[model samples]
Target: MPIHGIGIDILHVPRLAALIERRGLSKLASRILSPVELDAFCSLTSQSENKRALAANERGPTEPIVRFLGVRWTVKEAAYKALYPLRPTWKELTYTSFDAKKGLKPELVYASLSPDTTPAKLHVSASHDGEHIVATVLVEQG
Candidate 1:
C-alpha cells in the first residue's frame, strides 16, 4: 500500500485543562468524544465521585482525565489533517487499543464518509508526557 497522507499534532496539557476549566468537562467531552468514548470517559470519572468533596461546579477534572482529553484532542486533530477534504465528523471516529502491557498502539475506528474512503488503512500513534501530548496519523490506500 502507498501512503496517502500523514499528519501530526501536539498539545499542551495545561492548555486543555484551562479549556476544561472554562467549559465544564462534560461539555468538552461531548463535543470531542464519540458516543463510545463518552461512555468510557463517564465511567472513568464517575469512579471517584464518591470520594470527591467539592461539588461538580467547583471541581476541575483529575489529572488522568485531563490527560485523556489531551490525547483525544491531539489525535483527532491529527486524523483530521490526514483525512482533510474527506472530513469525518468527531462522532464518526473512535479510538481503540489492545494489550496495554505490550504498549498499546492506537487505532482509529473511522466511519467512512463515503464509499471511496473505505478499505483504507489508518495508523495512529499518540503519547503524553508530564505536560504535553502528541499524535501522528498515517493514511494508506489499499
Candidate 2:
C-alpha cells in the first residue's frame, strides 16, 4: 500500500449559516449528505426545531444545524480533494459511527466504480473552532 493523497479544508461557520438562510437546511443537506449521513443530519435538524419551539439555545436556534453543515461540507470537500482524479459525489461518500471506534468513519459508496484503485484506508480528522471548522483526510491506496 502507498499513500495516495492528503487534503485539508477549512470552512467558516457563518458561510454555512448563510447557505442555510438562503437555500434552507434540508435542501442543502440532501445535496451534500449520503443516506446514512442524512439520517443523522435529519435527527440534528429535528431536534433543533424542537429546541427552537421551546426556546432558542444560548448559542442560537440555528447553531446546531450550522455546525453540522459546516463539518460535513469541509469533510466532503477534503475527501474529494484527496480522491483527486476519481472525484466522488457528496452522496457517494459518507461519514458515520461504526464499531466501537472513538469517532466516525468514512465510507466511499462509489468505491466499486473504480475497479483499478481501492482505497485501503481513509484517515480523517475534523475540528471546530468558534466560527470555523477544519478537516483533514489522508488516503492510502491498495
Give the range of the ten consecutive residues with the poorest summed lDDT in model 1: 48-57
Per-residue lDDT over 25-135 for candidate 2, one digit per residue giving the tens place of the 0 to 100 score:
668888988888899987887787776663433444376677777887898798889878777778877765343566635443334345665555777888888998998
Separately for all candidates shown, the number of backbone clashes (residues 3 or more apart, or on different chains) is 0, 0
TM-score of 1: 0.88
Assess candidate 2 and give its TM-score to the true structure. Answer: 0.81
Candidate 1 segments whose C-alpha is farther than 4 A from its true place:
51-54, 101-104, 113-116
What TM-score do all the candidates reach, one by one?
0.88, 0.81
After superposition on all C-alphas, the RMSD of every candidate to the true structure, in Å, is: 2.1, 3.8
